[model samples]
Target: MLKEETVRALEQTARQLRVEILKMLNTAKSGHTGGSLSAIDALTALYFHQMRHDPSNPKWEDRDRFVLSKGHAAPALYACLAEAGYFSRDDLKTLRRFGSHLQGHPDMNKTPGVEVCTGSLGQGLSQAVGLAIASKLAGRSARIYSLLGDGEVQEGQIWEATMAAAHFKLDNLCVILDHNGLQIDGEVEKVMNVGPLGPKFLSFNWHVLEVDGHDIQAICQALENADETEGRPTMIIARTVKGKGVPFFEHKASYHGVPPSDDELTRALEHLGHS
Candidate 1:
């Protein structure tokens, strides 16, 4: 069982990451806000508590890999990387600016901790599949994790990669769905029904786990289970609210790519317990 103190710390860290993501988007005045907010909790649990990585040695041979399959949520990944000490937190404000490493998507060559350039809807999972295959072939214990948006799964490539991972029995691979329901256009169901997600993955021969994405403890437990299980990959469906911590943005697809204005940022900061 996860300790209470540890759960509290993870929860606190997640909230902090959310605030930083909002700040980065607000500073850039252009970025994916809803998806970023939705993903920070899972990203936080990965960087802060789960993945084995050296911020100083990003290319460490044994380090676990992380891929943001839903590349639009780059702000969340960037914020988590900064908080994990990959780079200065100050760099977050440079997001989307010309000459900045923090581009609109996760660019591998540009970002120290980003493993691949991912923004195209369905390509990230394929990249993760390749990483997992490489790790297994090299007899490396390093695990590869990919976080995908529910909406992004509408892409055919996601299913192709899913089949490949299971076929290879890439037990070291784990994929997480930030199932926040809403996408840029509207709710995921109305846009593209990806429902019965758990059964779908199960049928594909994966170990499936579902958790409330906002619940840090549940997320940690699900990830721990994934690490212990062998023979095939695991897929965690993390149910989340698109604009998670901030009341004004919660459940609203309108905020999908809109950064918080000054007034909105103030309210969001307060809600996240920022002083």
Candidate 2:
């Protein structure tokens, strides 16, 4: 569980992550912004308050693993990793640049802290299931966490992986769904609705929890509860706004993958009290 002081610290870290995310997106000129911002708080809570990871020993066998299945939100993951001391914050400016480790989508082979190379939607849950099975077979107590997008869950593979995870009874695995209700084209319901997400996961024999994605306290609680759950994988359905914190962008479909212009960035930073 996270102490009050730790939660405060994480709030600061989340703010820093948001700043880095904006800078990185501005530098890249091409990346998902809305989704990334929406998931930042949850990522902050996990890397800063919940996960057992080692920055100096990225490949430590006993360390917890995290997979950003919603690969388009790589900026959030990269920012969290940097704040957690996995890499230098300077590297963030190079995001999506030619030959930079910070690619548009996470590349595990190139990035120190990323566990899986994910960008194709619906594949991350499968990868997490494999990691969980491996940990169990190796007699390791480390847990595995995967963050997925609600729109991505429309893919058939996710449900298939969900079935496999329950079949294997990988209680050490936790899946978080960023339910922001927006996709690239338009609202998630208009693109390809994946509603009743909680019931769907429950029917698949997984433990399902719901929380506000922006609430760090709720995020920590869901994670802690996942640790206590037995005999099944846990899925957290986190309802979130597309562009949390930035008022002009919140729930705005145009900001999904669009970067803020110089003027817009300035206004956004001002709104966030960065100025």
Candidate 3:
């Protein structure tokens, strides 16, 4: 169990990151808001607690790698990266703007902390598998982590990667599915059902675990369990709400690819205690 103080601190950090994500999206006027907000808590737990990364030495050879498989949630990753000191938080305002390193999707060549280029869905897991294989071959202790959307899992390539990860016994790899229930179109079940994820991953020979995505302690505990498990990759199905912290946006599909408006931004900031 995590210390109460530590959990409180992480929760506070996540709330602050939520504020940042809303601000970034509202400024860009055209980024995914709901998914970004939905995934912030998990991303926050990983960057602030689980992952071994150096902001000043981002290229450090032994550091763990994080891939945002659902790259439309780039705002969430960008906020975490900035808070981790990979870049200036001020740069977050430049998200999705022309010539900004923080583009609509993650670019390895552009972003300081991003491990791989991920925009097209269903590809990030494969990249993470490759990185895990490389780390094993190189005898490095670096672990590879990736986040995928429930809707994004509808792609066949994800299954292929799932099979490959098990075949290779990529135990150093951990993938979190951001099961936020809704995508751009509508509810995941209504659009294209992908439930019972635990059994599916288990059949693929993955060690499956489920957790409340917004609970920092639960997330951290699951991550720690992943670290201990051997001979199979772990799939953490994190159940989350679409738009987590904002009252108007929560679970609303309309906010998926839409940024907050001027008035919405003001209300959101006030709700987040940002003033």
- Candidate 3 regions with alpha-carbon error over 4 angstroms: none
Candidate 1 lDDT, tens digit per residue, 1-275? 67999988888888888889988998999999998888888888899889999999999999999999999999999998898889999999999999999999999999989999999999999999999999988989999999999999999999999999999999999999999999888988998898879999999999999999988888989999999999999999999999999999999999998999999999999998897
How would you order the candidates by TM-score, starting with the best?
Answer: 3, 1, 2
Each prediction's Cα lDDT score?
0.93, 0.92, 0.95
Off by over 4 Å in 2: none
TM-score of each: 0.98, 0.98, 0.99
Please give the lDDT score for candidate 2.
0.92
TM-score of 2: 0.98
Q: Candidate 2 on 1-275: residue-level lDDT in tens?
A: 57788888888889888988988898888899999999999999899889999999999999999989999999999999888888999999999999899899999999999999999999988999999999999999999999999889999999899999999999999989999999988999988778889999999999999999988989999999999999999999999999898899899888998987788788888888898
Total backbone collisions for each predicted model? 0, 0, 0
Clash pairs, model 1 backbone: none
lDDT of 1 at 100: 99
In candidate 1 the C-alpha lDDT for residue 75 amounts to: 94
Ranking by lDDT: 3, 1, 2
Model 3 scores worst on lDDT over the 10 consecutive residues at: 188-197
